[model samples]
Target chain A: MKSEVNTVNNNISSLAQAKPLASPAVQIDFLNSDDLIKFETKLESSALYPLVSSDIDIFQVNLGKMCNQVCKHCHVDAGPDRKEIMTKETMQLCLDALDSCNISTVDLTGGAPEMNPNFRWFIEELSQRGKHIIVRCNLTIILANNKYHDLPDFFAKHKVEVVSSLPHFSAKRTDSQRGKGVFEKSIEALQMLNAIGYGKADSELRLNLVYNPSGAFLPDDQKGLENEFKRRLKNNFDIDFNELFAITNLPISRFLEYLVDTEKYEDYMQELIDAYNPEAAKGVMCRNTISIGWDGFLYDCDFNQMLDLKVNTASQHIRDFNAEDLHSREIIVNQHCFGCTAGSGSSCGGTTT
Target chain B: MDNSYYDPKDLKKFGNITEWQPKLGEKFFDYYGEVFKEGALTAREKSLIALAVSHAVHCPYCIDAYTSDSLKKGADEEQMMEAIHVAAAIKSGAVLVHGVQMMNKADDITM
Candidate 1:
């Protein structure tokens, strides 16, 4: 039950409340440093300058910013102390929007989406709509409290695709990026998920694990990492998972703070820029995913939502849902966008390529 | 130019060696690439081997490159460390085994 202090809780003057960091302007300024090439310029070279949406097929909803763990590289800066959450009213607005659109997949993220009081209710609503639901579970939350202990069962009941972050299978690596004892709890949570139909060879219940690098490096090949994760987890713990999503940690929020503090910002950004793949760029997730904030604000993607960069369309909120406007509007690109386009490219689902 | 002998940035320019010597550079790169492909040893195993050899040769660039490579290939920290330890043992053993030569020389001189 040991709770790691967050940037807000630590009262580190620069990172206090994470509000200044949350300001899109401030983050944009940081991204626009003199040395780095503009992400837009790179996209332009690849004939992707005005990155537009193909289809708004996925709705990545940030349910809240409250979580039991404070992961070092969390772009959301979500933690237990944060109170911002999507009210049932907002959930209803989202539901109304979903009804109006053809968006078939609903991806729920947060400090832990389950921390939202109306989480189950919102899922129940989405379930009834027959929308494919993906919950970005932190895994530790399932073991964090008594109320959350049955989360696996609840997820299985809804046939929710459970995507949990387990940065590394080893305790030291996982605990370092996440929190101490996080790996142990996550293993227990995975085992629980396995005991049910989730991750079984014969089961439809999809249980995917996410592996972002523990540091500033880009993620390796998805298939290779997945094979390794599968072999190690199966042999070591007898655990089963459907897939491993090798995500690259975007430079923003807490991860931005880390890169700057370690004097690795320029190097990491350069690394991202150098490793930029045009093929990967074409498949960037922002083109297909519209991220909705807790308060109903919309953005191009989850990283954009954290930076407070709303989508360019006039339909800026769930209540003002306009599929046509959203689809036509040019997606926002910043230096942080390099993260998603680097190497294999990263998305909430996994590598785009 | 940087005063130091090594610059991490140079690693990215490694492919550019072909600009000066295209044939040899291309051949070397092709050979290197083909050597690391999945063979009797998994690509993951090759990456670990490369990491250990990177350490043994004390090449900072290779060490940096292969450490990230090994991790990307899903080689965990323990396995990586163990590979390095194997390199360390061989390196030390190479030096220690030469002590037998010293013993032989001393015996010849003294006798």
Candidate 2:
């Protein structure tokens, strides 16, 4: 009964309009491949067989995939529509492991960690246990909803170390990587955090910003980029942060799709492979960190966690936590490990050397 | 053995310029290296300038090299695009400004 000519336009929400940007171009097995393994062998000493862990000092927990913004380069493919979340039971199990496993830092991450319903409860428990809590916050989340408006105050109260991702100090670059209006919200959120003494001199309320390259390349000198970010942010927005962490974009999920879409997958992979630094490889974060997914599965690193490459061990869940076994287990690796080992190396904490 | 004027493989043999005139080629490379080093302008700024000039000169090899170099030097997409626009505007203006010569010639020859 409608007219042939259109009148008022009906459109879907951005979230509804969202679909994955990257898809596998060819049928290729990223894992169990001979090329990456051969490359690793050439880079390693005679003792390199199964890449093993040293000790689990940093326990990173992915709360869920629910996020306010769907970034083009997200490895997790996490968005608002993702209903996966860690249950309180799993959180309790993780807390129990932390108590026994001598874990020093509890690194909490997610599509947006704050979006988790039990985020506060888990943080409170970790804080009470005297664990150094690092919340991998996406700054826009602080300004996403009215309830989240008080996040800065809450973070300050808990003395949580907030590591937020700000792809660039410039609005144009940041918005292109994230979404429209995201850069403004992130700036507002940063200002709020600064007002609460989060990034102040002689303040324990530490606030660090994260930077990842916005394209198919490795990040430049971390210290130089950090200085540029600090100078620009101070001059333009009157903002300050403890430090900037420049992360390399891993070749997985949306980024992999981007590589395939642009026909640069092999070239980019070759670049990473060619730039492999043995010194950087020795300090890869997987040696000391263990990542736990929302559904209780474990991984050597977050990238492995996203790729469903669970920790290479029998006891691969928090419920089956065996400190000795988990600590001694070999790390699960693929070609993507090159991302972390290239140049000065990358991890949740930024450059290795 | 191909008869094509522009061989795709010629781009790969860019380093072989020294084969013909080693001394001059080496000097040109050394001067080129010195010019691109960080000075009053940061490496990033120099890279953007090079990218713009590459577009103006319309050199495919230079364009490709400078595009990657500019990105590695921390130039984002918007900055790169803006640099290209700068090149485009200058190129367009250069051609238009030369049109004044045509106008003068036409007036002087007219009866």
Top-lDDT structure, candidate number: 1
Q: For model 1, what is the alpha-carbon lDDT of residue A11?
A: 19
Model 1 clash pairs are none
**For all the predictions, what are the DockQ values?**
0.60, 0.39
Q: What's the TM-score of chain A alone for every prediction? A: 0.95, 0.91
Task: Give the lDDT of residue A137 in candidate 1.
Answer: 92
> Tens digits of per-residue lDDT for model 1 on B1-100?
7799999989988999999999999999999999998889889899999999999999999999998888777788899999999999999999999999
Q: What DockQ was computed for model 1?
A: 0.60
The prediction achieving the highest DockQ against the true structure is 1
**Per-residue lDDT of model 1, residues A185-265, tens digit only:** 999999999999899989999999999998878888788888888989999999999999989999898888778767778
